[model samples]
Target chain A: MDLALLARLNEERAARRAAVLVTDLQSNTQRLVLEKDIMADPLSALLSDALRMGKSGVVESDGHKVFLTVQAPVLRIIAIGAVHISQALVPMAKQLGHDVIIVDPREAFASPERFPDVPVHAEWPDVALPRLGADRYTAYLLLTHDPKIDDPALHFALKSDAFYIGALGSRKTHGKRVERLQTIGFDEHAIKRIHAPIGLNIGAISPAEIALSILGEITAKLRLKPDGTKIGN
Target chain B: MLATDDDLLRQAEEWRREGRGVALATVVETWGSAPRPVGSHLVIDAEGTFMGSVSGGCVEGAVVTEALDVIESGAPKLLEFGVADETAWQVGLSCGGRISVYVEKVT
Candidate 1:
């Protein structure tokens, strides 16, 4: 590996951009293909599949073997409320290698004492989310259950390329929420993206169990194929 | 502290920039329930100091030993380890898996 190439790879990671490091095992030569340039590459099909699956492996390219080191952006969890479930979620999400960020306008809930060693924003979603730069790799958790905060956050999340957007609410609550979203100009297709009554059907009762279920659903979204089958299973 | 792949790659660059001879070992191939997936990285310096794992601590020792030679010579080496191979029997993957590692020096 060249020092310059390693530096460039790290640079892409810091910027949250996706890149694939292609290494020809026979020649020991290497080249990097950025996500934007994958379609132009000769091995575009293989490269795109690798990027979509976020896996790195060896592939046969024209009778020679080349290793594809897929460097996708690290996944992030932007929990919209600094509440009980969020407290439980912070450490669990971190253990799963997803960076967790908390945002709440209430200074009481969003404090260092409650969430230590985590980045907690004591500002409304409108003020905090833009700075967070939520992208396709982000999973938005609207746990506050407060429309004042979650609704504004949804506007930003729906507009962005965030992969998983889950809101904590009951079916009745979600019905009203959908009506509100419709009034705000979000169509049926866009509004359908939110996973209402969030998390898997784990029959969670306590805060910790709910947190676990939410993470379970997030993991499914991250790992499952488009047809609802597990990837690499 | 769990070190992610991002951290491992960044540390490799840091070690190389500090004038230390560094070699990177990556799991390019895996078979039969390999603990670490492909693209996992293990970085070793000249002093045998290494971080990260390619096979859940089952083969780091062997990979680091091979990496030292890779650091000495600029040439890269492809090492395959499994329970069946004679050379890999000493550090065989207990999980009954096979992994091919690509070890190369950072220039």
Candidate 2:
């Protein structure tokens, strides 16, 4: 409740950066742990574990107990096309508490009738994506097969901190897409972030099934550790 | 809007700023039929003013009772409510679950 702590917490929230506040039970002392500063914190192990898992809890450490509350921004998904896959994906993402926005310049596909109660931007990805402020917490999906729609957004997304970037295409199509991105000066490292052939290899034939796998993949990436150094479940 | 962790923290902080002694009880761990997930918080003030819920209509009165003492004595309490425990029936967690809550005085 100190003015300094309150202001710092507000600043982090406003900037959409993640933070955690830990209150020591016995001493009644408290400290704020920003995601960026986690490595340097004394409770770095506990703090980073909580942040990575996106859950907070109390712990007994060195005979002292403290409660840590993580304050991460809501995960966001920016789908670049209002196509059939998006119709299934948007509602699923919303149900999982992700903020979803569909961006497509084509009005016919981006109509309210197709995506009822969902936020649709009938604007090009180049225009809509900038306004969305896609950050590290945001995931991007390029659904349109059109180079004009998906490629421009790729240029924006690859340069930014979007956590996940996926494009819908077959393996051969993705190879060609990779070639195009390479010609545009995208390196192998940057382009590798895109999960082309879009969803997980769950043999999904229907749009809804594909949507399920894509969300499953996203959640796996979001929740699980690649090196399997997962902390608290 | 659904109350988030930050929202409850802010409410507890604001209450402390307003010269009210506040106790924060957070569900630290749970097992079996624990309705509330870990990290869920309930903020209680000196007069028993509160925001958020640590349990879904179960065992909150006991938590609030302990919170009042936390506010008075400036000490924190680690409380465990469970169907296996003696106070579970009195606490009303009849769903056969164990929940560990940590209550602390937040100055």
Candidate 3:
């Protein structure tokens, strides 16, 4: 029932770290639900459920309704090509609150002169992907048409927990590329996650259009289920 | 109440102590080009109260009715409205879109 402890718990939760709050619902008084007590307390179960689901809710404690708010951290997008499509995609993704990093071995393509505001990594994917350590929130996009540039990145993406992995190319090129991945021991499911011939089926021709389509697909994948239901489901 | 959810909750508590009724409306689902995303919230009180939006005025009237019902019953209900509904044009939204709203009594 300590308000100061509840405020501290809220601050910790806002920082994307896990913290639990217990409340006497009838009195509208709250207590910090610490990690140590999570194993034994029923309220901690609700907190864990909310954390797992990335949801906020009103929980009944004692006899009152206590609002539990959980804030999920932002996701990261690793663009493995500094092409024209990326020029448009980076800013758009940033607007949507994604942390974006552009990577390319070609110094001329991956320069601060081209992308003044965004982070550009002028190293190859082999060196960069390990440093990044892909998580569930990390999305990887291989925009370089060159297999030499994309293949290593794809290998790392396939090994990691990245939610979305897309590679830009024509259908024919993607088919050939899939064959190469198969040779490298990638199974069908792993290759399927690549989203080759990237972007939604919007028939995009211009670079900006292509970027829009890619972002649309990314948004759909991130926010909506395959059945078109919202992600909370 | 000033800003922030805590302030709003405190205000809601004070209103309850003063015998005022309040309802909460949340956007649970949207379909075929909804202007607002799911999980968006709007709150309404006894005296035609309002806060936030569900669908750019497309379903506010329907939400208001639902909110009144929630306030009366003190129970939550999930309501769906779309352009396909016969009365959708009367509410100013007939763009062939749909939304599911969850209405609950908050105070």
Candidate 4:
């Protein structure tokens, strides 16, 4: 471990960014592993493969021992509505370690007084979605209940790499939404990516409970195992 | 694993100041169905006391033995284990996956 590399690793650790030290045992050399933005590190990439194969290990590093800790990256939730569900989901998602953003054109709903301490963007989806680059770690929820707002956001989301995209509506509304998406040239596979009537069926009645179900489903999808995997019930 | 980097360095330095020998074990590589991933670590003292794990419980015995040898010889050894690997199964890692472990005495 050279002083310069050690200093860099210390800086990353202080920032609480996930990092791994890869060391060559034969040569007694080490290198730090860090991603450009939010891609999986070598440890996570290896672990993801291991989790698929049900394997784990304690690989050695240049005379020093190294441990692979699975640190889940920060979950970003982009809510394109400032409705009741948004109000409920923001606090709930924050408690679950998600960086939540509520985007809407209504100043009355998207104001700081309404959603204190949470990021609010009073702009159209075309305007707001570009600023928030969707990645594998991000989940998009369109609860605007208006085609003019939700459809554009879904269009933007479909073009990105977001792992989960959900839109709020009844089955009839979603059916119409899907037709509109098809008219816009999204294929069936791309349309399948959207989780309509978003949220798990926990028999939720209120906005808060519904928000819980949505977050629950998001967690389930995020933590889903790679190869026909199921979480411990 | 319980101790942070600063804490581990401090403890190791204190032990060295007290004239105690220390050995550090690290996971170098893993292949095909191991219990822990690469980069797992464990540290041991001259008396064969150990902290942390490389394979949960499957390969600690061999790791400790290697650590003891590293401490004695003041040299490092790369240990490999798997169900396919002959030497590792005796130490109880008979689970069919291979792991490469490096044991070295820390100055």
Candidate 5:
């Protein structure tokens, strides 16, 4: 491996970007593939799957063997509302290798002592999320049912490339939320992206159980594309 | 099996830079009862050091043996083992499953 390529790979890691180093065994030639540049690679069609799955492996291409060394950014979760559910979720997300941040304007709830292991932001989601760089690797969970808090964040979550957007609300509450979003000019498709009644249908009744369901749903949305769409055809 | 290093590629790179010959074995495919998921890796260095796992305890020894050969010969090899088969039982992978791993030098 060349020093230049090694440096480039490190650069991607530092920037928290997903990429692959494609090495052809027959020629001993290697190419660095940042996730953004996947479409331009000759093997782009075959390579994106590995990128999506966040795994590196040898691939057969036109009778030549290619080794794809995958590098994926760390997963992150931004949970709005330092409520009881978040108490359970913060640690659970951490256990699953997620860097979790709990954001709330309530000083009483968003205290360092309460969540010593995770980062606590005593700011509104709209204010906190932008500083966090909303991207494909980010998942936003609106645990607070307050419209003033969750609504502004929804504006940004819908507009950004955040992979998963989930909010806690009942069907009736979501209906009202949908009406509000429509009044604010978002189309039906954009409004539909919010996974209201957040979490999977796991019949969860407690804070911890609901947190588990939400995390499971978030993981599913991240790995399998939202709306159950397949990538690269 | 899969060891502590979550990022196997970086570990392999470090090993190579340390003057250790390294080979990476990745589970490209798996079927029924396979402990590790597809794309799991086990990187073995020339000095008989390894990190991460391809098949828990079921197939690491065989993959490590092949990985060392891949490091020496600079050749890539594809391996398949079925846990249900009698031959596979002696080697490992007796959990009644099958997996295909691709071993290659990390150049």
Candidate 6:
């Protein structure tokens, strides 16, 4: 690979942009294809497929073999509360290779000492989220259970392309939350995207168990198709 | 913190920018129950120093040795290892898997 190409690949990744490094196995030649430029390339079909599946593999392009090294943006977990669940979530999420950021307006809850090793923003979601900028790869965890904090974050997450938006609450609490969102102009279809009563149907009582269930659900959302079938199976 | 493949690539670039001879080995293909997935990387410098793994440490020694050759020759080589190989007892995967690694010099 060319040094310039390697540098560009790293640059694209740092900027959280999806890209693919295409290498011709026979000629030893390579090219870096940014996500935006894939459609214009000759190997657009193969490149798009590989990018969609978020996997790298060798594909047959016009009878010759080419290896596609797909570099998807790193997945991020933006927890809206620095509560115990979020504290438990930090290490587990990191182990699953997801970058985690904790946000809570409560200074005591958002202290770095409580959530050591992860970024803890002691500011409201509205103030911190914009600076953080949630993208398609971000998973929003509305664990505050405080509508004042979680509602604003939900507004931003609903408007964005965040893949997962889970809010911590009971069925009764979610009913009230849904009513508030409706009055605030969110339609039923949009409101349905928020995974209230968040996490899988596991009998979780402790914060750590709840965190595991939430991560499990997030993993399912990430690796499974909408119909619950595995992606690229 | 676990060093991701992204970190490995960034470290490889940094090593190359420092005027060191660098070779990158990627698991381009895997068969059976491979230890590491395809696209996994093991970056080897000319001094036989490496930072990542293409086979979960099963065949990294052989890969680093081949990567050193690629660094010196500036030619990419595709290497395969499996239980079927004659060197299986030495450097093959213990999981009874086969993997094809593509080793190339980073110029």
Q: Top lDDT: which candidate number? A: 1
Which residue runs does candidate 5 get wrong by more than 4 Å? A1-14, A23-29, A53-60, A65-70, A223-233, B1-5, B17-19, B31-33, B72-76, B82-92
Residues A1-233, candidate 2, lDDT per residue (tens digit)?
34467557767876889999887766767888889889999889988878767787777777887778787887888888899999988778878878788899999999989988678999998888898886789999999898889999999999998889999988898888899999989998999899988888999999999999899889877866777554454
Per-prediction DockQ, in order? 0.91, 0.42, 0.05, 0.14, 0.27, 0.89
DockQ of candidate 3 against the true complex: 0.05
For model 4 chain A, give the 10-residue run with minimal summed lDDT: A49-58
Candidate 1's TM-score reads 0.95
lDDT of model number 5: 0.81
Error of 6 at B67 (Å): 1.4
Give the clashing residue pairs of candidate 6, or none: none
Tens digits of per-residue lDDT for model 4 on A1-233?
34355455555644434444555445655566654432455445654543333222344433445444223345689899988888988888877767898999877878888788688999999999997676666789999899999988999999897879999989999999999989979999999999988998898899999899999989878666545367421
- Deviation in angstroms for A215 in model 3? 1.0
Tell me how many clashing residue pairs each candidate has. Answer: 0, 0, 3, 19, 4, 0
Candidate 3 off by > 4 Å: A1-53, A59-66, B1-107
Which tens-of-lDDT digit does each residue in A26-54 have in candidate 6? 88889999999999999999899899889
Q: Model 2: per-residue lDDT, tens digit, B1-107?
A: 43575677778777887888888788887889888888898989999978888888688998999999989988678888887885444675778788988888776
1 or 6: which has the higher TM-score?
1
- lDDT of candidate 3 at residue A20, scale 0 to 100: 50
Per prediction, fnat is 0.97, 0.40, 0.00, 0.20, 0.17, 0.93
lDDT for model 1, please: 0.92
State the interface C-alpha RMSD of candidate 6: 0.5
Residue runs of model 2 more than 4 Å from their true location after superposition: A1-11, A59-63, A111-118, A227-233, B1-23, B31-34, B44-52, B68-76, B83-97, B105-107
lDDT of 5 by residue, A87-165 (tens): 9998888778788988999999899888888889999877888897877888888888998888888898999888889
Ranking by DockQ: 1, 6, 2, 5, 4, 3
Q: Pick the candidate with the highest TM-score.
A: 1
| lDDT: worst 10-residue window of model 2 chain A | A224-233
**C-alpha RMSD for every candidate:** 1.7, 3.6, 8.8, 8.2, 3.6, 2.0
Worst 10 residues of 2 chain B by lDDT: B86-95
